[model samples]
Target: MSKSVDRKMSRGPSTEDIIEDTLPSTTETTVDKIEEISSLEKKLVRKIDLRLIPWLAILYLMLSLDRNNIGNARLGGLEKDLHLEGNDYYTALTIFFAGYVIFHIPSNLVVKRLRPSFWIAFTMVMWGICSLCQAFTHNAAGLIACRFFLGTFETGVGPSIPLVLSFWYQRDELALRVAIYFGSSTCAGAFAGAIAYGVLATMDGAHGIAGWRWIFIVEAIPTIILGLLSLVIMPDLPSSPNKRWLTPEERELAIQRTEMSGNTDKQFFDKKQFVAALTDLKNWLAVGIYVGLNVALGSYAVFLPTIIRDMGFASLDAQLLSIPPYVAACCLVFLISWNSDRTMERGFHIMGVSSLGALGYIFLLASESVGLRYTGAILVACGIYPIIPLTLSWVSNNQLGHTKRAVAIALVSMIAQVFAIVGTQVYRTEDGPRFIRGHAVCLAFISLSGISACVLRILLKRENTRRNQTYGPADVKDLSTLEDIDTLYDNHPQFRYAL
Candidate 1:
């Protein structure tokens, strides 16, 4: 059972005040930590954030552009140029997720095996090359091949990011960092629109190439440059022995933090943990949520420009209009994630947003009025985009060991990428102008996500309660003396899952 760690200089120090002061300040702390986060840990976290997040954010933005710019390109005449019709465009889109799903587990394992810096940077360069190749593709097969390889190479970075960030950040600190990383997608969405508008306006006829080709070339080059920069700039794992960027004390503390929370032993391959990940119910629940998100996201990324243009705007106006929703989405992503971290709450926030997103789809499906339908798009962006980091952080928060966490991350990601494949194929050109079927399917899935969050929260809460009854409430004071901890993991009596 747990007891309070009260430092009362005055007789009047309330129990609530002790709890408040003892809670994490600006530093990283474990679930049952007695002291506030130290200034040293806070400084180390800030240093890691500064050294790691910006370059990661930039590259993530480029990745989003390279992956989702196809919608923008289509508006700039990619379809006509490539002779894509009927199911050809959908096939190209589907191929990306096919490779994305196939490579998730393998890519994550490779990153764990090799140096994080080299592995991530290498994949970034490869994906950049694949993105560049898309600009030159003359037919469906060429585009599909390029897209497939692009997804394959990108698997190294995107799916493993939360898992990677988990190494450097604690459960308390990770949601916001992950949110910041995921926010790049919204920025890229906005940026993609603005860039497409500019390219279509200025570069369509220059060098006798289509504006869509120019879009690919412009986006691909920067990704390549950023990839090269990553070799020098990217931070390796916190547990890695050699960190030239960190001081000796800071590096020691960084490594210590990993071991402090639930015994994250340094094993690249733990078969027992891998098996645990394979059988975990929580991973599958997360997969449902992620699949719901990607279902909406895939359609939104690939079809938003077309949707806007279909709403009676010119192609250029549609491109320009697309930027606002993404900008709005990016802002909300920050606000929601910050609140989620501040309160240390996950499930309810995810539930609220997914429900709101489903309502947005309802508005879209029910309305023939163009203004109302556009409002629906804004609501959907605001609602759906924020759930991404929330869900990923929750998944990361629950897992115990490094290998189990890594495997769990990859497992959920691979399954979600399966639905991501479905996400691209849901939108048919026949249902175009107002793609009712895609909107309906997205609505159903988003609703499923909200319901799943509620159910999973209940399940986890019940399990935690049962643990308290059976094992006793988790006590921080008692936990420091724990031995042979690696074998127990989440089974350890003191380990608590964050709700």
Candidate 2:
């Protein structure tokens, strides 16, 4: 858990308060809030939106499926199969995150430069191949190597997907869409368990390898196939598309819309702009929020199935039962996103959801009733999944320039994932069967998140008021261009930060 630290610099202006005051009052009006949707001419946005979700979802699904199949594998004797002892499995988990942190920033930069279609698909194939290699692990060293490569390949996909969504959708439309994409990861969690159950039921001892190996091998094949297919179907970008896939009219509309919003430019790396982005205290604040949330999330990801198995279900049945929490999460994600979009509010929605998650963890920590614990599981599934996408959309929407947004997104994501290493350690197998320590840890983190969301909202509100007083007019256009505004907010009068 985190304590409040006043990071105010004594010599300089209260940058925190200044940052708070920079949000535009125009953004606070109900009429302005309702306008995130396009005009009637573009009413078919949902139809096209539907097409985009499956590819993004499938991509995330496989990414999660492969990464977490280890939980299911653990049930099928993976530890024994690979002769793991002490903390070898936890070490493998930590190694994946180490590789994950190493590649995340560069991978995001590549996604910003190259086509998402090609680069993301390439990442998919690479991770899928590594996941398949997991099936061949005969020792701790082999598993570690495979997991490292798997993490290196999959590192970017999580951050890249939100970056890609920010490009196409407005701030309002993005939250729900992001939830849909992120929700798929929860679905993958469920699907992986269910699929693993099926795989184990039929092929327990059939292969030269164990049933755990079959889970990895079979799950991996679809990922590889999907990766290759994505190269063909994935949209390149709003600016540079495979001309064959889009009509000239659609391309023009994309460019024109971005220009109308005063943000049409390719993101390029610049040393000065990068430094300004890094310097913003809010950037680091956002990272802190995510790190706490992720530590809780990662604990659930790596240990929930194991926890269930300890609760009297057989190994296979434990795997099968893991499906419901994630399935419920998928539906809750869409519901929460829609509500957030309709209300055009991010902070409250996030606080509310995270609070629910904290409550779930508290329930698990306090009670021993199986039925009550199962309910807590459902609450955990629904509550945590929405925060990620909402938080991501909030960060991306508030950031002004393309280059700054790119780096900021990568930084938050990478910093958050660093906690995955911490999380993997917190929920050790020895803590199973009502992992009291694990539950308490997650509860503490979720409480931190609830507190942070309040801080961010208050900061945003104060900033919006200050911007109103300073700017003189809500419709000022002189500092509106992306290039001009890029460095203007760094103690400069010309730029205004968005809330």
Candidate 3:
């Protein structure tokens, strides 16, 4: 019997032994678990997109319309009605951004402490009240007061959305999500023109009010309504009990996935993180790029109607014509951003788009043809609008901690708005019809943006290569266990930047 057993063992054991040998190893099991978690994460992302994106888009759309309706109001007799002479109209426009720039960092910090849902809603209500007051303003001072207060309340909404999005999305997923949110502002431009045309054409003297007054009153209603609705709709942080939309399991997954993606630290307001962000060279490069693009953006947003009117279109025709450039812009922004997310490249996309805008400005400066000028406006819109979200997401992508990201985004945006004061001042009354000086300044800025983007890309790529060479072959999977380690957030050995 012993000889028979020995013979069977020599024949490679029994069938059960072979079967056991074929089972997956520990590494394979881990890989399978990772794949399963990834699948679950994708599903979670889809659910989040459905619930969050559309409402945020609508909220931004309303906010954008309120902020920009002043441009449309300018076309609808706001200047003449309020007796805004010389630089008073421009002063009103400029002062809004003054308040806008001052409050951005503070507002972002407030969102970090309070629930974003409540804070955003509260600010929305305040801005809506301010917008409604614009309809009642009878003079330049009254309009400027309403504009300044309107900007103060609006500062929270713009920066807070990107900060909130960073909490939910990975860096790779952020560009398109931000594009959708920021792109809504472009849609609002188109909608603003259409709405302005309708109100000015139909409601010119309705109820003893001018068409421009009706624009302020009518636009404010939806903003106030949406503001109230946002209190119930906006999701809080993943760790908060106020996140009623997510299950306990989903919340755990949210936190784990975010941490695993290298957004490891979660302190509320770290001064160290703030100092780190302030010291980073990349943040300032990003700000320089944004300042260039936002100069064009601020100018286009506030002066499209006036520009179109100078092309010999009637007030009604100019308002209607303004719609097309913005519509084209909306489409281009979505296209570029979608490609940006897919290619996972930001610097080239920003540079190339800004170059396109610079070309458009050249067209405006060199030609007197109405058709050529209109085409220039379309190209400019397409180029400038997409850069807003891309540049913002770029800052968010490079920053490591929540507090760092908040400060970086707010600081860069605030700096850009400071330059936007220059933008508002460029299109002076003395330079109408052609606005040659304004076009020249915008072109210079856009060209500067393209150059900065190139330098930034090269610098980031070199840093990534240096890190890889120094670290050799580190395991990215080990990043999830970083809570046990004492490394600073985003400075982990295996944390690679998205170049």
Give lDDT tens digits, candidate 1, residues 92-114.
99999988888888877778678
Off by over 4 Å in 1: 1-37, 477-484
- Winner of 1 and 2 under TM-score: 1
lDDT winner between 2 and 3, please give it. Answer: 3
Error of 1 at 27 (Å): 24
Residue range 29-118, candidate 3, lDDT tens digits: 565565555566667788789888898999999989998899999888898999988889989989999889999998988896888889
Q: What's the lDDT for candidate 1?
A: 0.81
Ranking the candidates on lDDT from highest down gives: 3, 1, 2
For model 2 the local lDDT of residue 378 reads 75
lDDT at position 382, candidate 2: 74
Count: clashes, candidate 2? 7
